[model samples]
Target: MTHRVLAAMIKHETNGFNRTPTTLRDFRDQNFHLGEAIPRVYRGTNLEMGGFLAAAEREGWELIPAVAASATSSGPSTDEAFEALCMPLTNTIRAAGRLDGVLLGLHGSMVTASHDDAEGEILRRVRELVGSDIPVVVTLDPHSNVTPEMAARATAIVAFRTSPHTDQAETAERAAAILARTLRGEVRPRVVLARRPMLTGFDGARTHHAHGPMPDALRRARALEAEDPGVLCVSIHSGFSRSDCRAVGPSVAVTGDGEDPRFRSIAESFMDECWARRGETTERVLSVAEGIAAAREWRPGEKPVVLGDYGDAPGGGAYGDGTAILSALIEAGIPGAVVANIWDPAVAAQAVAAGAGATIRVSLGGKHDPEHGGGPVEGTARVVAVSEGSFVFKGRYGTGTRGHYGPSAALEIGGVTAIVTTKNKGIYDLEQLRIFGIEPTAQSVLAVKCMHGHRAEYEPISSRCLDVDSGGITSGDPLLFPWQRVVRPIWPLDPVEGGTP
Candidate 1:
């Protein structure tokens, strides 16, 4: 029998420490697509309709597209905005009677003004509307803080394995397929969550070789998946503790048979491994100054120096407007440099007003959190080029996806060209610059405001790259921030407990 399925995608990863509160306006600023707008804006990559369509075609199930809304990482979403986003989906589900299954794409770290567990709240509402027996599957970013509520509500859940998250579509397909199988009575879905005290240490937790203990744990989990005939997938969620929610920490989830002790044990074992490798994971990192110094003198032909601007990382709930690195480069007189996407909507508007080739005095960077990034760099820059902000993915990360910078321009300030945008998108595609008349390959130094995801794309083009410990909300150092809600004795915060307090 063909079943009817409902699907929607609404995602946002919030950093509680950010000064600016995320609102519906911020979503507009970031170029978020509501239900119908997704197809027109984002085409292929992680398209909400694509997942539902793929499942419907493959399983002969009727599909309904309700809503799809996503905003870039920021502070807790206002209560009004959260409800505004979720209402459309809940209303559709209510009207649909009963659904055979449901699929949702969630970031898993959304902190709303009224709710800390935004995903869980949505799940609870959806479960109430659809009832508990209907299979619900979810696709999440690896950075998710998987709450108990989420595990209890979602029958089958999968997380993108890579940090750059190029596999979003693949992960969504897997979740949808799993839901279809469960609905067809071909498989029963089960889940168990294992918690670790320490926050998943700074970046690279997604890296294959540098992942340290994660690779081994994943290997063992895969073995368990093979051994247990019922086990379909095992996921290690390196939780996003920057969210400052109650359910924040690393987690292990195994999905297959209902409430299997073996599955729970397998997940627990992986959590133990994560706890064991806490010492090797370094959280506090070097500053941009330190990273620049290292890169300036880096061996002529060494590994591409990846300069990860943790402070301004768009993926990590930052404003992505920090100018510390750009200012430093100017001061040091670093020649042959490229900086992708300084979020200066105001400046972008000014440039559009002035037109290309016109020299103008513009304020760039530090618009959102002036105190953190040192409040705007004022300068007269030549607007060499302008675009409506369209670029193709040429980098290793997001290779197949299309990126829109949303009214972008290249502002040349001496030897360096700063790619400015009205939208806040981290540098994951090389075309982000090339499309705006700035090619990164020819540059001696490139600065990217990203957490770890930038490595996948920039590493291929960079002669050398280094992660800068720029001081901001998403810093590598966990101890630098005062986390009150996180479980006690997690890593460098309380080393005596070995991060298990």
Candidate 2:
């Protein structure tokens, strides 16, 4: 029996605080890979689409292709635009008649003009169209807000466990395989989620290195999974609290059936551990000086130390224009370095105009909000390489997902090289540089704008990495931002003295 499975990707992570609404232009500006334009291999890596195709091939199923639309992180999507995006897919699903299963790639943290729980809304509508019999499995970003509506509406949800989300394709493969297993009656899928009260700041929730409580919880999950046969998947979702929603904060979810009490017990155990470890997570980050010093002192090793500048990640709806870290690096005169994805198109154009090897004075970064990091700094730079930013990768998770760097170029100021792109990407892959003739392995210092996932690839080559204290929309200091509705009473925000509420 050759079953038919429909697959599509619609993703947008909305930072409600950001004034810039996610529009069609924003999507086009930030490397919108729509329909067939999506890369066969994105930035030297294969993408989730490859995983779906692989799974379908194994199952002897016919995979129906629909539109896959992904925009960079931005403010809330306009209601009209979101509806327009959803209707086409929804209408397609409605008209498709009976389908065996559906697969969707979604960023779980999307908050649009129409709904706070955009993924949930999508799933709920899809559920209405597909009914109870047809199963729907979704692959999500680890930072997604796991709402009850989403949990109830979808049959199974698999997400990238890593924060920088290096495991996008791996998680997609897991979801697709799981969906196939469910459809084949090999395993009955069930989801039991345990909720925690405390809310964590973005920086404190990283799963890599000696990161927040999530890593320890993941260890516990591994142990529990070994003991319980019914536990198919254990997801420790450190909820994206930036979008003020009811299902905020960290949660533990177990997907399986046959043992309700056991599932609840395990879920609660992990949830309790998350709450216990919340006090250890802090927002008092190291200064840029501290970061530079730490990076210099790190000894050469098998795994490079990864410094995550979560504060200035453009993926979190940041302007990606901060100059604080660059200034610090320039002052330190660190050699053999590359700080990627500075997001200065004008500077890129100026460099392009100057032609390769030509020396030109260009303004770099700080165009979005100069007040945060003192805006752009003018410097004499040489164009090192100009590229279309093409590469293929079987990602760190080993899922063979293709990624992209769009139209990218590299600029050198002093000894440091900076990658300027027309697109805003949060994750840093080797292909991003390798495609442009810049090899990261040759560099002593690698500064990238990402929260955590950088550890998978960049960590292997780094001498030392430090989460540089920088300023942008995703600043690690949660206290700096004023929130009207975040379900607070945690960390520096509450000032309870006990650390986390």
Candidate 3:
């Protein structure tokens, strides 16, 4: 019998504190393709959907494309937006008769207006449509908040082991392979999950440092998978702390070949590792002033000095409108520097309307959360270049996947060139700047709005990169945010039994 499998993707990372509600337009601006368009856009690409296509071809299963939609991380998705995005996936499953299996590409840290555990809700809906008999497999980012409901609904789950997430396609292939084997009557898979009471851990999932706590835990996870035939896959999630949900923290999920008590034990053992190293961090955060000083003092030889504007990163769901770094750079009169993007839609539109070569007085960035990252920079901007802000990723991360910055322009102000963008996207690929007429490789200093994802592409072209905790919602420290929904007595937040962190 020829097996039929359905594959779909709807990935988003929500920042609960962001007042801006993520909408359908946001998905469209990034990458939204339904039905045949999904395969057309993603085929042979580095995205997870590309892996799904390859798996189906390898397994000789009839591939059914549902939808492929993803948005750069931002505020919690609106109810209407969430429903619209999920409808295509659920609808495809509802109509896919005699479906043998389902493969999903998802980010585990998604939070919507109606659902905190958005991945769980998606699985629940899929289970409702397909019933429990059909094997379902999911691919996730390492920064997912692994909820109990997600484990209960899916047969098997896999996550990207790399922090820079250069292994998206590889991770998807792993999950799809499991689904194919299940359909072929090779194995019965079930996911068992375990988590500690901490709000965040695993050095925020940074695998750049090979000997870090995350890497150590992953080694053990891989060892467990190799040792036991029953262990299908072991996923260690560092969790996304920007989300204000009960399940918003580090976790371990062990996908066992069948029901067994050992799966939980294996998961718990991994969770123990996560708990023990809850206070660890991967990056040395620098103040805005210090970061600016470093950039000013850069003696450019081979590569540019990159400063990670981490606190206001769009990747971690911050507004990305923080002016702290840009302001400091301007104040220091740093030359040959470019800030890839400042997410101020209005200012971007204004610049585009004025066209290139037009000089205009503008209040740049810090409009969203002025209190956090130095309330806006006021200056006369010379519009050097303007663009519709669309390009394809050319780096190790998301290669060939198309992205849009909406309306964008390179505004030269106070000896600094700031790329003002209507849409917010983290700099995973150098093309994000190159397309906007700002070649990062030739610049003296580059201020990128991302945490770890940028490392894959940007680090090679940088003399040194420093994480700048130029304040916003997505700052490195989870301790800074006011707790509300997370389960109490969590380590690093509350006293661990009788001891302190």
Flag regions of model 3 displaced more than 4 Å.
Answer: 498-501
Candidate 3 residues 190-234, lDDT tens each?
A: 999987777788888899887888999889888887888889999
Clashes by residue pair, model 3: none
Candidate 2 local lDDT, 216-316, one digit each (tens): 66666667667876777787777776655555566666787544788778877776676556657533467777788866664544333355666677677
Candidate 1 positional error at 49, Å: 5.4
Better of 1 and 2 by lDDT: 1
What range of 10 consecutive residues in model 3 has the weakest lDDT sum? 492-501
In candidate 1, which residue ranges exceed 4 Å CA deviation? 28-43, 46-49, 201-204, 208-211, 282-285, 298-306, 392-403, 487-489, 495-500
Taken over the whole model, the C-alpha lDDT of each candidate is 0.76, 0.70, 0.87
Cα lDDT over the full model 2: 0.70
Once model 2 is optimally superposed onto the true structure by TM-score, how far is the C-alpha of residue 197 displaced, in angstroms? Answer: 2.9
Residue 103 lDDT, candidate 1, scale 0-100: 87
In angstroms, the error of model 3 at 99 is 0.7
* Ranking 1 against 3 by TM-score, winner: 3
Q: Evaluate residue 158 in candidate 1 and report its C-alpha lDDT on the 0 to 100 scale.
A: 87
lDDT of 2 at 181: 83
Number of clashes recorded per candidate: 12, 23, 0
